[model samples]
Target: MSQSQLVELDEAAVLGHAGQALAHVYFPTDCLISLLTHRVQPRSFEVGQLGYEGMLGAAAALGVSASAFDAVVTGAGRAWQIELPHLRALTRASRSLTLLMTRFLYFELSQMGALAACAHFHTLEQRLARFLLMSVDRLRVADLKITHEALSLILGVRRASVTLAAGAFQEQGWIQYSRGHMLVLSRAGLLQVVCACYRQDLSTYDQVMLGSTAAQ
Candidate 1:
C-alpha cells in the first residue's frame, strides 16, 4: 500500500498495447479502462472494461508480463497504481492477494464469454443499453461525457448506428444526448431495454469474487 501511488488518467490515454510488457497495474478509483482488440489501421473494439471494482494487469500475478489486449483510459479520473515488479513481489508474499487475483481472472473470463454471446445474439439497441448501464454503474454518474463517434469504435458499430440508437433512446425518454454528452434519464427504462447478459455478468462476478470473499 505504501508503494502505491494515486494518479490521474486523462481521457483516451493509452496505457499498454497487446503483446507489450506491462510496467504497472492500475486500480481505478473513478475511471474506466477499456481492453481493446488489435486490428488493422484504426479498426479495433473494446472486449472488456475495468473500473473501481477491478484492476488492470491481472496477468502480472500469473507470472505474465505481456499484455493480451490494448488497455486505454476511456473515462478520465484517478487510480491507484503499482509497478509490475512491486506487484509481483507483493503477490508472492501474500497468499490471499494471489487467491483474489485468480478469482478476478475467472470473473474476467466469464465476462468475456458473456460479451461474445451478447454481441452475436443481442440487438444493437440492447447492446447500447447494456453498455450505458455498465458505464453508469462503474462511473456512478448518469451524465456520461462521451460521444457517438467514440461509442462506434467501442461497440464496433457504425457511427450512424449509434446515432440512430441514441436518437431512439432519447425519444423514449431513457436518455438525453447532445454535443457528445449523454444524460441518463431513467435507469429503469434502460433496465428494460438491456439484454440478459448484463445481469448474468454481474451474477458471475458476485459469485466468483464477492461470494468467495464473503466465504473467507
Candidate 2:
C-alpha cells in the first residue's frame, strides 16, 4: 500500500467521495484535481485544487475522519499514492515532510480566501484569466488538454459562458484552443488580464512552500 508509483485518472474519476474517510494520499506530479463541495441541489463548486506542488489528502493527516468536499481528477497525469498509515509515519519521522504539509495547508487556506473574494468582486474575464494562469502553472505546461465543459466544472460556470470567454481569449491572442486543448500564447498577457487574486495566491504559496525561494 506504500508503493511509490505514478498513476493516471480519467476525468470525473472519484479520488474520494464526500464524507468518506481518506485511506490514501495522492501527490500529483503533473495531474490536477479539484476539491468540490456538492450540494443537495446538485450544484458543485471548486473549493480547492491540487497539482504537482501539493498533495490531496492533507485532511487525513489533520485527523479528519471524512472530507466535506469531493475530490475528482480533472486532468490526466501522474500521481504518487501512499497509504494513510505510511503517510503519517513518514510525516512524523521527517521534519521536511511535516514542514511541506504545513506549508501546503497554509497555501490551501489562502486559496480558499482568494476564491471567496474573487467570486464576489472579480469579473468573469478576470476570473477566467486567473484560472487559466493557475492551471498552466500547476501543470507546468503551456498547453492544457481540457475541454470547456471540464473548465466549466472547475470554474463553476455555465458551459456557454466558458465557451464565450475562451473565444475572447483566443481572439486577443492570449490563448489558442483546438480540440479541447488550450495553449497559452502569452503568459504575461494573461497575467495582465487577470485580477489581483492570482498574484495574492501565488505570493502565499511562495512564502509558505518555497520559503526563501524567489517568486517567479
Candidate 3:
C-alpha cells in the first residue's frame, strides 16, 4: 500500500500502448479505464472497461508481460497505481494474491467476450445505454462528464451516430444531454434500454472477486 500512489487520470490519457511492457497495475477507486484496440483503420474501439470494482494489469499478474491493447482513461478520476515489479514481488510472497489475480483475469476475459458480442450485434442505442450504465456503476454521480465526440471514439462509431442516439435517449427522458456532458435521469429507463451484457458482466465480477480480495 505504501508504494501505491493515487493520481487523477486525465480523460483519454493513454496508460498502455499496444505491445508495450506492462509496467504498472492500477486499482481504480472512482476512475474508469477502457481497453482499446487500434488494429483497424480510422478509429479505436473499447474492448472492456475497468473501474473501482476492477483492476488493470490482471493479465500481467497472470504472467503476461506486455499489453495487447491501449489502456486509456475514459473518465477523469483518481486511482492507485503500483509498479509492476512490486506487484510481482507481492505475488511471490503471497499465494492468496496469486489466486485472487488469477480469478480476476478469468472474470476479465468473460467481460471482454461479452463486450465483443455486444459491439458486433447490439444497436448503437442499446450499446450506448450499456456503456452509460457501466460508467455510472463505478462513479458516485449520475452525470457523465463526457461528450458525444468521446462516446463516438470509445464506441468506434461516427459522431453523428452518437448524436442521433443521444437525441433519442434525451427525448425519451432517460437522460439529459448538454454541450459536453450527460446526466442520467432515470436508472430504470436506462436499464430497460441496455442489453443483458451489463448485468452479466457485473455479476460475474462480483462472484469472482468479492471476498476473494480479503484472501489477498
Instruction: Identify the candidate with maximal lDDT.
Output: 1
> By summed lDDT, which 10 consecutive residues of candidate 2 come out lowest?
37-46
In candidate 3, what are the lDDT values of residues 33-144, reduced to their tens digit?
9998854688878888998878999888667878988898888899999998888888878987888788988898888899988999999988999999999988767898
User: In what order do the candidates fall by TM-score, top score first?
Assistant: 1, 3, 2
TM-score of 2: 0.90
Q: Write the per-residue lDDT of candidate 1 for residues 26-98, one digit (tens) a residue.
A: 9999999988777457667777878899999887756886888888888889999998898889999999989
Instruction: Show how many residue pairs clash in every candidate, following the order shown.
Output: 0, 0, 0
Can you give the TM-score per candidate against the true fold?
0.96, 0.90, 0.94
Q: Which stretches of candidate 1 lie over 4 Å from their true place?
A: none
Give me the runs in candidate 3 sitting further than 4 Å from their true place. Answer: 211-216
Per-candidate local distance difference test = 0.88, 0.81, 0.87
lDDT of 1: 0.88
Is candidate 1 or 2 superior in TM-score?
A: 1
lDDT tens readout by residue for model 2, 68-179: 6789887778889888877888778887777667778778877877886786788878888987888888989988888888888777778899899999999999999999
Q: Which ten residues in a row have the lowest lDDT in candidate 1?
A: 38-47
